[model samples]
Target: MTVALMWEARAVAGRGEELLAWVRAQDLAVRPLRRETFRAPQDRVLVITWWDAPYDADLPELPDPDGELVTRTVHRWRFEPVAEG
Candidate 1:
């Protein structure tokens, strides 16, 4: 099975680009099979990484950006695909 790690954060006021740049510069300890990034309204940034492991597996995650760049603490979630067989 494969797992997905979702990390999200919201920038403080006009610092969205700064926060996004920080996210793009991160180096993960464990490389993922694939990764994608998204931007939303309200200065929100979302990153999704796909890994070849279970949801409970230990994987390297993106650390929180500097305090001045974000409004609140970072949020993260793990997910697994439902089996059809």
Candidate 2:
């Protein structure tokens, strides 16, 4: 089953653009089938990656940017599609 990984982070104060650049420059160890990134109010950044592996598979996740760039710890979630059968 394909799995989707979601990663999110909020930048400190007025460092939203900096945080976004850092996230854009990151290189994943394992390339996903599909990947996308977005930004929202409150200096937040979100990234979603779809992989062709099991939900519990060990996949290389984007490392956290420098602490100074973020306000708090990064958040992550994993999900798999429900089978119709």
Candidate 3:
């Protein structure tokens, strides 16, 4: 079954791109549905993606959110495709 994993992460000062870059380098992360949206100031971003498999990948370590507001949240959602409106 297809599943969608919503991942939100906040980056340190100017490290948003760095984090995205690292994930993009991963071979399994080439899924086209893995959309990434970066908030202005390049310090915060939210990634909501659909995957054929579960989100069981190794996540890179970044500065703690509590320390630098590097917030992160992960939620697993069962997803299905419907007729496009």
Candidate 4:
């Protein structure tokens, strides 16, 4: 089974870009990771990351998301892709 990991954060003033840039450089830590922009407001940012994995054990879970996730809260989603697209 494959899973998609979605991460979000609300960045402070001048931190969004810097934080995102840092994440992009962490290619060696996580594999098959893709980042996308959900929205961007002044002094706040909403971003989503998709990570392909074989199973839960193959994923990197962020226990303390607050460090990177600058929002009030964060969430995770697990799903199986539809067939016959």
Candidate 5:
């Protein structure tokens, strides 16, 4: 099966670039099949990693950034694909 892990965070005011750079620097202990990063208004950063594993399988995920860099704790979710084109 294929699973996707989503990690999202909102940086402190005017720190969007730093936050995006930090996310890009992170290295997962075990590499995923694919990974992508995104950013949006409000200094939000999102990272999605695709893996070939069971839904409940243990997997590596991005760790939380330093407290001074973000407004709140990070948010994460795991998903299994439901459909495709």
Candidate 6:
């Protein structure tokens, strides 16, 4: 099965660039099948990593950034593909 882990965070005012850079620099203990990052107008950063594993399997995920860098705790989710084009 394939699992997708999503990690999202909102940076403090005017620190979007630093937050994006920090996300890009993070390293996982094991590389995923694929990974991607995105940013939005609200200074929110999103990272999605695809892995080959069971839905309940333990996996590596991005850790929380320094408290001073963000506005609130990070949000995360896990998903499995149910359809495709």
The per-residue C-alpha lDDT of model 2 at residue 3 equals 94
lDDT tens per residue, model 5, 1-85: 9999999999999999999999999999999999999999999999999999999999999999999999999999999989767
- Against the true structure, whose lDDT is highest? 5
RMSD value for candidate 6: 1.2
Model 5, position 35: C-alpha lDDT score: 100
Per-prediction backbone clash count: 0, 0, 1, 0, 0, 0
Model 1 pairs whose backbones collide: none
Candidate 1 overall Cα lDDT vs. reference? Answer: 0.92
Report the Cα lDDT for candidate 6. 0.98
lDDT of each: 0.92, 0.93, 0.50, 0.53, 0.99, 0.98
User: How does candidate 2 score on lDDT?
Assistant: 0.93
Candidate 2 off by > 4 Å: 83-85
Instruction: Compose the digit string of candidate 2's lDDT tens values, residues 9-48.
Output: 9999888898989999999987899999999999999999
Prediction 6 TM-score vs. true: 0.96
Per-residue lDDT for 8-82 in model 3, tens only?
566676687775665444344255445554454656655556656544543322222343445454323344556
What TM-score does candidate 2 get on C-alpha atoms? 0.93
Clashes of 6: 0
Residues 15-85 of candidate 6: C-alpha lDDT, one tens digit per residue: 99999999999999999999999999889999999999999999999999999999999999999999866
TM-score of 5: 0.96
RMSD (Å) per prediction? 1.4, 1.4, 6.0, 4.0, 1.3, 1.2
